[model samples]
Target: MYVYDEYDQRIIEDRVKQYRDQTRRYLAGELSEEEFRPLRLQNGLYVQRYAPMLRVCVPYGLMSSRQLRKMAHIARQYDKGYAHISTRQNVQFNWPALEEVPDILAELAEVQMHAIQTSGNCIRNVTTDQFAGVAPDEVIDPRPWCEIVRQWATFHPEFAYLPRKFKIAINGAQSDRAAIEVHDIGLEPVQNAAGELGFRVLVGGGLGRTPIVGAFINEYLPWQHLLTYLEAILRVYNRYGRRDNKYKARIKILVKALTPAVFAEKVNAEWAHLKDGPSTLTVDEVHRVADHFVDPAYQALQDQSALLAEQQAEHPGFARWMARNVNGHKKPGYAAVTLSLKATGYAPGDITDKQLDAVAELADRFSFGEVRSSHEQNLILADVEQTQLLALWNELRELGFATPNIGLLTDIICCPGGDFCSLANAKSIPVAEAIQRRFDDLDYLFDLGDIDLNISGCMNACGHHHVGHIGILGVDKKGEEFYQVSLGGSASRDASLGQILGPSFAQDDMPDVISKIINVFVEQRHADERFIDTFRRIGMAPFKERVYAANH
Candidate 1:
């Protein structure tokens, strides 16, 4: 919830004005498609499979109720009546007229929002845990650091266009909810034995055609040197990273080729030149950024466990939702509530304009006038009182967001595959829907427990299929779409990439394929084990055999 200063306001306003002229030129044929490509991409406008898609940046996934209403208005007036929340926690309008994009951005500017750095080969949104400040297990509130990094990276002239799109993630919690290891730069705030706070920096982590967990480049980078160190890394990448091949241009590829130690040495040598430079963050500035994220006025109320228990006994549905969607908060008597977007029938992350408006109102009433969008494509009211849980649950149910399937088999992470993305080989939305329908049994789904089933339309890994407990990637087979399955991947503290499970299956056969895999886990699991735990315990052979036995 960082408020925009005069500098920030002036920057986006000017950017909007510049982009408006650029758009006008393109429409008037003064700028050809080739000429306008980088211009449009710099502003987060993409010419997708069908129409132009506009990705609006939501810094660290934080949105004020006012900003949320503005987005609803944009969706209603300029584009389609809905928006999609991407895995990166940015908002995408799937159907926007190319001519109206400038207008959309101008509207976004009014609310301290923009699309800059959201696309193109530049530093993207600096994401952190959606529950950054409120999580019980938090070692530090990462929002301030994320904001600091965001301020530094935004419009940085040097990194304006890297070899490929760059992403950075920060995690300050014990749980690694931010999936820091899967980003180009992952910053984990660690407290040393000497009581000083610094970041354990990881580099070369990505999940595209080549998936690799980030390596620890700097075991402990001091807080003061954060910007200078990042500058050093980017400088190295910009200098030697592959410019010949787009496929081999990412920092990860460079890191792999040079080896992490050599990369670290290069970064260290680069940092030697820039250490304690002007951009080095001061304690005062850290506090200045930190001031923006002060906690809400929390009441000194007792825990509502008894009241919730009574309600749970009365309504099993409420109990189910409480078990799945509600999360622990640092403060007593309060909890964070996730409104499910994976409600079986709709696209995984799609939220209608009406729902956006309603969520804004709900955030105002329940969560201190702010809402957080999670990487899982769900909206969160991060400070809801436990006493008001039932009321919130009832409203979410009416809105069709009270699906008790968080962390269950039905809570799928799916990309807008061939349906929207031109890069996609197969359709992911229908495949996700099919799997959701197949796993409709709530009791059965709960038994399956904490299974991350991610589906990507292609290997760009927008769906992060590489990190899912059950990963599904769409591949092209002789002009037809086939789904490839992978298992044992996780993006948690113990991060690892999944291994593929033999051959690809036709779209129609996906549901049966997933069912067989689940059956193997169900048969092999020990008491109280989750799908991931079972898969790790027994390995992939049993599941692979079950899935492909008939063909064999």
Candidate 2:
């Protein structure tokens, strides 16, 4: 993980002090709710349905054991004793008192963390693959670039108040685990024919009331031109993005109205002047950032673990856990393990303070004192030794974090819908819970095989419903809650938005609808084909036909 430099430290401390003063003024009636709104939002505080929620950034989803422990402390002392991991790989506390948020941020500052840019109509947290440095297929680690962008975007005067919230994601692996296609800006590091490093830049992609995959803006931007090229994109958005209507303010809308080609042309015209500016990244600065993320010191060991193999043979539950939770690591004897938060009857990404502390301790004991939050809202210890797998599992089991459903049906991705979010047309968490209850059998989930069931409260797609194999979107029909279904959406390298099935269903009918869709996939799929592959091969007609047959 990258350590904060003096500049980084100074800026965060200043921001914290600024927010603390702003908070005091708001409490003293010097600032009204409307006046304090933007200030609080800039600090990542949101007034929710029941209470205020604070989202803390976990830069590029990397946290030290020490940082994790601090977060656990914050959760315990300031807010409710639990935190929800968001789809953007940030941790959100749902019960923070509005008055105590400044104090919480001050504490976070001590650990080189904060909630800045986690919300508001500005550039939000920059996300990348959680397995950045460790992935086998990576051409180069993307964390350095992510950090660079983080610094540039933080409190950027030009982009501080954009037309709407903008998100940027970077991916370095062959797989699109970061969901680059659905971000305002997506950067994929690519090597040219001559083996020089660069990025494939995509723009105008987003998921919301309107979902659009990003279009290719630049095929290859050299390493040195990253900042310049990014500035160009933001400049274009800031100048022409709609300001009249909140609903039409996103850059995606501008891109759609103008067409991607004209959008690129506008950005190119802006880049003509700023291409060689001082902010452009240089080799030395790149090295300075990259050096912070060098691999942890790894001990040499045998290629395979005899004890693990023996244990797997003895215990089926442990065997199943190892199959789903453990990932291949670049190191010989180490594995990356996911501590699933999707246990039955619980919210998908909710982890209590005690569980967070336990995970921090476990990371220090078995891994390299590092923890990662996945985009799927799971916790990962990236360097656990093969020999320690069973012991770690035991500890995690005690903490209620050892659910072996990483890619299973029960491992759902859901947004904090009507229960918390003011924008939601209906509640999504209850719907997710209902579906999980209907399909609680682990064997059945495993047999279903790598199904992605995502639910969003509305079209904002915070839950990533568009890319789910079975996407569920909440809709409003004459002020009543309803759900619309989509099939075959995927967020991998061959990314595609899902197709709608038909008429929306009432909230009570969601589980049955989902079950019917799954049954059709089970019945229609050829042997050895995944749900996505099956959907692609046969199209959505069969599932759509089956779902609305009675209505038709």
Candidate 3:
């Protein structure tokens, strides 16, 4: 919840003005398509298959109720009456008119939001755990560091155009909800024996045509050198990363070719020039940024466990939802809630304008006038009072937000595949919907337990399929769409890329394919084991056999 200072406000407003002129120039034919391509990309506008798509950055997935209302209004007025939340915790408007994009950007700027650096071959949004400050297992709140990095990277001239898009993630909690290892740069806070703070940095981890978990480039980078070290890493990538081939341009590919040790050495050598530079972090700056993320006011109250238990016992539906959607909180009388967006029939992550407005109202009514977008394609009420859980669930249920399937198989993570994105080889939304419908049984899903089912339209991995417990990727076979499935992947504390199960299957076979995989897990799982754990222990043989065998 970092408030925009006067300087921040001025920069955003100025960018809006600049983009407005660029859009105008392109439309008037003063700029050719080739000339306008990078300019539009730099501003987060993409000309998709059907219409222009606009990606608006939601920094670290945090949004005020006021800002949420602004988004809802923009969705209703300028584009289609809906918006999609991305796996990176950003928002996308799929049907915005090309001419009105600048108007959309202007509206976003008024709310201290923008599409800057959201697209293009530059640093994108810095994402983290949705429950960053409030998670009970947090070592330290990462929002400050995320904000610091965001400030440094936004409009940095040195890295305006890299070989490819760069992503950075930070995780402060014991659980790695941010999927840090899959990012170009992953920063994990650590403390030495003296309890002094620092970071454990991972580099060159990414998923596309090739998937690799990041290697530890720096075991312990001092907290004071955070910015300088990041700069060093980027400088090395900017200089040596491939620029000729877009497919091989990512930093991960460069890291793999040079080997991790050599890459680390390069980064270290680069850091030697930047060590103790003016951009180095200071205790005062850390405190200033962190103050914006401090705990909100709370009245003295006891835990409502007894009351919730009684409510759960009375209503089986509520009990099911409570078990799946509710999460632990640092505050005694409060809990974080995940409003599941993966209901049957709807595309995963799609929120209608009315639903967005309702969520804003609900956040103000229940959560402390703030809302969070989860990396799992769900909205979060991060600081809801335990006393109001029942009331909140009822309202959410009415709004089709309480699906009772968070962390379940039906709670899928998916991208707007061929339906919206021209880059997609196949349709992702329908595949996600098909699977959700096939597994609508709440009891069955709960029994399956915590399955991260992610689907990507293509290898770009926008859906983060590489890290899902069950990852589905869409591919084209002679102009026809086929789906490839993977297993044993996780995006949490034990980050690992999923292994491909077997040959790709037709779109219609996806549901049955997924079902067979689940059946194998059910038959082989030990007591209290999740789908991912069972896969890890048993390997991919069982899943492959079950999915591809002649008959069950």
Q: Write the per-residue lDDT of candidate 3 for residues 1-552, one digit (tens) a residue.
A: 899999999999988898889889988999999999999998899989899999999999999999999999999998779999998899999998989988999899888999998899999999999999999999989999999999999999999999999999999988888888889999999998899999999998998888889888888889999999999999999999999999999999999999999999999999999999999999999999999988888767789999999999998999988998999899899999999988899999999999999999998888889999988989999998899999998998899999999988988999899999999999999999889888988778888888899999999999889999999999999999999998888888768899889889999998898888888999999997998889889998878877778654
Clashing pairs in 2: none
lDDT of each: 0.93, 0.89, 0.92
What is candidate 1's CA lDDT for residue 350? 96
Candidate 2 residue-wise lDDT, 166-264, digit = tens: 999999888888989888999998889999999999998888888888898899999898999899999999999999998899998899999989999
Give the residue spans of candidate 2 off by over 4 A: 305-307, 550-552
Models 1 onward score TM values of: 0.99, 0.97, 0.99
> What TM value does model 1 have?
0.99
Model 3's alpha-carbon lDDT is 0.92
By TM-score, the better pick of 1 and 3 is: 1
Error of 1 at 145 (Å): 0.4
Arrange candidates by TM-score, descending.
Answer: 1, 3, 2
Runs of candidate 3 with Cα error greater than 4 angstroms are: none
lDDT of 1 by residue, 1-552 (tens): 799989889999999999999989988999998999999999999989999899999999999999999999999998779999999999999999999998899999999999998999999999999899999999999999999999999989999989999999999999999999988999998878898999999999999999989899988888999999999999999998999998899999999999999999999999999998898888999999999999989999788899999999999999999999999999999999999999989999999999999999999999999999989988899999999999999999999989999888888899999999999999999999999999899998887788999999999999999999999999999999999999999999879899999999999999999999988888898987988888888898898888888987
RMSD of each: 0.7, 1.4, 1.1
